[model samples]
Target: MRVVVGTCGFQRGRRIHYRLLDAVEVQQTFYDPPPKSQLESWRREAPENFEFTVKAWMLVTHGYNLRLWRRLKREVVGDRSAYGGFKLTRENLWAWSVTLESASALKARIIVVQTPATFRASEDNSERVVEFFNNVERGGFTIAWEPRGTWWNNRDLLEETARKAGLIIAGDVLRERLPPRGQEIVYARLHGLGGAEVNYRYKYTDSDLEMLASIICGGGWREAYVMFNNIHSFDDALRFKQRLGGWCGS
Candidate 1:
């Protein structure tokens, strides 16, 4: 298996990150997408084989009430009432268009659509999840769904929907397991296990890294993406690559 390890964002500066790791999951896109020119410049500056993965904008997954909006720039103006919920509304469509454009600029291989804990497992929500993916123009990029809360309870529904829409189920490998279906590509995020939901400050132990490595390499997937989201993400990811005997790459 081709297991590539990297941080969720540029924990180090871009130049250092690009030189040390072969992959990165751009985090700013989740809050505020950078200009297309900037993303294109990043693509130009990185190594030819460097791989980029983009986090889908919150406008497509989060509700307006969520505190995540506080990080959004004041200059970003729009009637956000119709945003999020994965609905087939014009606002959500526009949000997706921006995300697609950003990914296209970076030549990213994956776009991670992360939903909040409130986005629970229900018939209506499930239907919308499938419909949104089916309707969106993915721009030839793979879509990874990182769902939170009770969505894990109904694996059958999750598996069926993913198969129908061609999605990769993303999860914190330490907290949850990736669905066995769609093993062609596995996306694993390592958010520290310190708290109930997610604790970015917690550091991973050596044993945790070993288990994580086991899970990624044990799978039948042809490729695996391990993105660390903890405080020591960069150091941990570098250690993870070393543990894998340096075979992991973009």
Candidate 2:
């Protein structure tokens, strides 16, 4: 069991919150790119045992709303003019690899590419997916895919493809979006056991934690990366980590 917690932004000396855990998922990269200095500073802050996992940028995930995208563009590129020219091509993929390599120096274990809900399962998108994987293969890092919407219907094929490409599926306990239970290398994002309509701030009951612990421990995988996505003001993830630590006697 490799437990991880999601962080909203980079904060100096904040690694103490997750020092007891195995890993931390830096969600800042999903919205904005952090400076190399900040990333290296975090690497120096944590103990050698700690690992980092970063969320893929929204541009890569196609999670752009006009206002949010523009805001992110201004923050990242210093101008909105570069936003329109931004394209998801092989070159952009290479750029992402460079960013991940910098993160690798900080001991990042996996790069999570969480697709937006709009990206449905279709043959057209499938090919693009394969191409994206090919482009990211240069960095010698692990890639985890988390697709929303009707993608789970083609779970078998997608799992096979992911395995062949040496990518990991980002499993979650959300309604109807769970990935296959067993894989040699597994990475999961536990967003709480609630329906889609549920608010992000909803706290996880003991039952919810127990169910997730069961799946993780029962799964045949030698190791699993479990990160909490229910980061809505409460420290449910940290509490859950403490509970899981006790259960696993870690």
Candidate 3:
């Protein structure tokens, strides 16, 4: 198995990034998709071996009313709650459409959909997820979901939904979880964790990297992407590659 590792965002210059990382989970997509010209510019600067994955816009996941329009940089004046969410609504599709444009510009392969902590695991939400995934025009793109909150407690629902939709259930490995179901690829995010949840200030230890390395090695997965999502992400990603005895590289 091959492990493609990198930080959540570019912590260094494109030239330096080309030397240290093989992939990046672009965080800007969640807030606003960069202009196509900018995406193309980054793509041009990156090496052919480098890969990018993007976080989908919050409009498709979070239910924050007008806050959604601000994040998407659009003018949609209405009852904020009526705009977007996990629902298979017109607004959600529009948001995804915008996100896809950026992904195409950057030649990104994976697009992550991360719901906020308030998104519960009710049957209605599960059904909404299925409807959205089934109807969306994916254009050969892979959608990985990192649903926070109560989802962490319901493996059965997540596995079933992901399998049926051909979606991958992304895991935050620092929370001691792996992809709910094995697919051709595995995607993991490591946000420095405290005993309970993400501790953005935390740094990884050598032993922690070893534990993650074991998971990335293989378990019916052909490829694994391990991305760091914390203050020390760049250094943590580098040390993880080192711990793997140089098995990882750009």
Candidate-wise lDDT, in order = 0.85, 0.63, 0.79
lDDT of 1 at 117: 87
Q: Tens digit of lDDT per residue, candidate 2, span 118-227?
A: 77676667766776666455466677888776677788667766665567787675344455656555676766554672345666777777777777666676777766
lDDT tens per residue, model 1, 1-250:
7778899999889988888887999998999899899999999999988889999999899958657888877344467788888988887888899999999999998999989989988878888888888888989999999888887888887777776777889898788657565568889988888687689998887788878877777777888899998889999898888777532222
Runs in model 3 deviating more than 4 A are 65-79, 246-250
> For each candidate, what TM-score against the reference?
0.93, 0.81, 0.91
In terms of TM-score, which candidate is stronger, 2 or 3?
3
Q: Candidate 1: where is the Cα deviation over 4 Å?
A: 74-78, 246-250
Q: Model 3: number of clashes? A: 1
The candidate maximizing lDDT is 1
Q: Which ranges of candidate 2 are over 4 A from the true structure?
A: 1-13, 73-91, 174-182, 232-234, 245-250
Candidate 2 TM-score over all chains jointly: 0.81
Candidate 3, lDDT over the whole model: 0.79
